[model samples]
Target: MNLTIDEIQDFKGKYPKQIWSLFFSEMWERFCFYGMRGMLVFFMISQLNFHEKEANLQYGATQAFVYAFTFVGGLFADKILGFRKSLFWGGLLMIVGSLILATNPHDFFFLGIAFTVVGTGFFKPNISSMVGQLYKPNDSRADAGFSLFYAGINLGALLGGYLCIAIGKGEIFSSIISESMRWNVAFGLAAFVMVISLINFVFTQRSLGTIGLQPGHPESELQSAPMPKWKEYGVYILSLIFIPIIMKMVSVPEYTDYFMLTVGPLTLIYLFYEMSKVTAAERKKLWAALVFILFSILFWGIYEQSGGSLSIFAAKNLNKDLLGLDPNGVNNSGGAFFIIFLAPLLGLLWIWMSKRKIEPNTIIKFGLGFIFLGLGYYVLFATRLFADLQGITSLNFFTIALLVITLGELCLSPIGLSIMTKLSTKNLQGMMMGMWFLASAYGQYVAGIIGASLVSTNENASNYDALITYTEGYKQLAIYAIIAGVVLILISPLVKKLMQGVK
Candidate 1:
């Protein structure tokens, strides 16, 4: 039953068997990741004694570093460590970070978060690049495979998002753990699941054949001399060296802004330099990918409010009787819950449309993503009208908002992953994937600013005052989203031409 890389790529059925291994591995890692994410704002506000505005900025800075590092990680993997080694190293770091937080979240908060930012940088982009390698270029099934992979991400997010928040807030496990220790238990759970993720990957990696081997390894398809011991050691040493530096930057929102401003242009310069070395056709495709990357920054910026401003909104303004659970839990897990059900149906829908020659082009899909995103924000804004005198809104309105947002995500994210692989030259695939996530870093950064601005400056701001401020912000976001969607649709032909026949 041994299968070569070629055989795995060409296997009969809707998905490769290797995908299941990757799916499980990614699922647990996401559990760890989203679990931590869902806890951050609430943890800072409750445990760290941070104000709402400060907590949102901190969340933004932490998340921005996590994603920006993906570019660095991707570049290093492309040049040296390869995907397998990068992922393993990243997982170990993540586990260590989680354990540190579990030990004493209040005192070591930034220190633990810094470690996770670095670990995620190394781990996240590489596995995704490996998934891209599972398919032949231009494979018609690529989108379906990515859609399924996207579902695995959500499955983990769904579990971690709800469970971790519930535990840390002491909504569940109240009898077993003291209220003081619940946060530590939540963090410990993240570390535990990360161990499982690393173990799963270790046992299943044999099935990958030579797909993720180091570039110069003896068994690699490149047929080059082995990479020098010094280079491998150097990458590991440099990552460790950067931990304190990352800690400092992440602790200061101003520093993060400076880092964000510099890193993006520099990344573009590097990409353009690489693009200059490729054929004209490949360059056109890379340009098309860049367009998608740029649009995604705005898409994620608005969509990600659920984790920032909306997280606080759920805790403060929304009714907590959502199925007898915390509204914040619903806010964190709702989109993923919808995605798990929606992804497969949408994947099949794409297949059905393709067979009938009625499938929308990727450009058109991107436009539609924004349209749905705008509509979703409008729904969130509408929650204001449903609020009682105390400013508590209907849980029903919030749930509907998440469903519309999920529809928008289905169009962009999985397709974005698939298109990055298709458009890039093989050598640049990892870096391009990194760039895609780096765009998300920008989105996170902007989302933080937006969230911070919407918060009332008065310490004595009322629930109703907060509700009015936040809902106004949501309305502005909706307008911008609709405008972006219309512009993208109007210019789709130009972008489609740049794609140079890529679907």
Candidate 2:
């Protein structure tokens, strides 16, 4: 029953059986992740009594740390724990964190968030790296595999995004669960699913064969180890030790800013140090990957408004009835809903285009993603024009905007993951994946700042004032997105050269 790495990667058909296992594992993990994400700003504003701007900053800081830790997690996985152990450890932490939040979200909010942040850092990047390992280098089916994997991620997001916020807001289970107990139930749901994710991995990881084994461990002799057991134990101990530090930084937005500023530069310096050792071709590909990373930060900064400013906007200025559902739930889940349906179709489209030798290169796809992103934000801005006298906008317009944003995300995110693996050497795969998610951390950090700037400083500002402010900010974002798209397209040729035929 045990398949070697070659046997697994060389399997017939569109995907390896192991992909399904990873898929389910990632699905439940994403449910936990997006569920917690959907609740953060809402919880801060309503329960923690944070102002809108302050909540935005805190949300950004928390999400940023969650992603930034991914780089650290990836490094540890690359150097010590390997993907399998890293994922298990991360899942355990996430379950504990969710339980902490469920115990008393209002009292222990920052502590719970800090644990989840660290947990996510370990869980997020390594699994995706493992998926990359399932495919041989330059395997044409890799994109499709990633695309399918992306759908599983969105499936989880759709469920958790809708359910968690809906439950926490008392929109669902109002009869059985009192308002006092709703938030607890929501947090509890995340923990429960995390347990499922970890258990799924535990039972199915054998299918992965040698794919996630620790660095320097040969596939032929799985028991042989180049690294010391003490080093592996050290990683676990250090991660736990850093939890309090993470808790402190996330609690104070200013401290997050300091951490962000220092961490990014230090990561770059370290990457360059590694780059000095790679071949010229690999270095060029790494440069191409860097370009993608840089652009992604901008893309996510604009796209991630859904969690911060857009969440608040849905609460304050959007119509509550979209088929009798809460607008906040719709805002949180809408993109994922669309992606679940769209990712496969897009993947097929890419395959079709490739057969004709006319597939747009990854750079062009990245550019197009930004263009769609711009259009999506423009639609969001236009919602202000449709506002009723009460300043509440149509949910239809909101849904349409989500669809457009989903299109943009489909173009960039999955492709970005696929390309990161394609571009990095085997030894650097985990690091490059970490860097990609770290870019998202920067994006999340910037999104918070942008969201905060748009929020009215006056505590008594009306919904109409909020609509005006947020729409104008969205308009600015649309313009920037369009400009970035155009610039990326213009420079695509240069980037293509740097890719060195990675398409």
lDDT of each: 0.91, 0.92
Best by lDDT: 2
How well does candidate 1 match the true structure in TM-score terms?
Answer: 0.98
lDDT of 2 at 495: 97
lDDT of 1 by residue, 193-301 (tens): 9999999999878899888788898777667788998999999999999899999999899999999999999999999999999999999999999999999999988
lDDT of 2: 0.92
Residues 1-503 of candidate 2 have per-residue lDDT tens digits of 37777788897987778888898999999999989999999999999899889999998999999999999999999888898889899999999999999999988998998899999999999999999988888788889889999998888999999999999999988899988999999999999999999889988877878878886566632455587889999999999999999999999999998999999999999999999999999999999999999999999999999999999999888885579789999999999999999999999889889889899999999999999999999999999888987788888888999999999999999999999999998878888999999999999999999999999777787788789889999999999999999999999999999999888
Q: How many pairs of residues collide in model 2?
A: 0
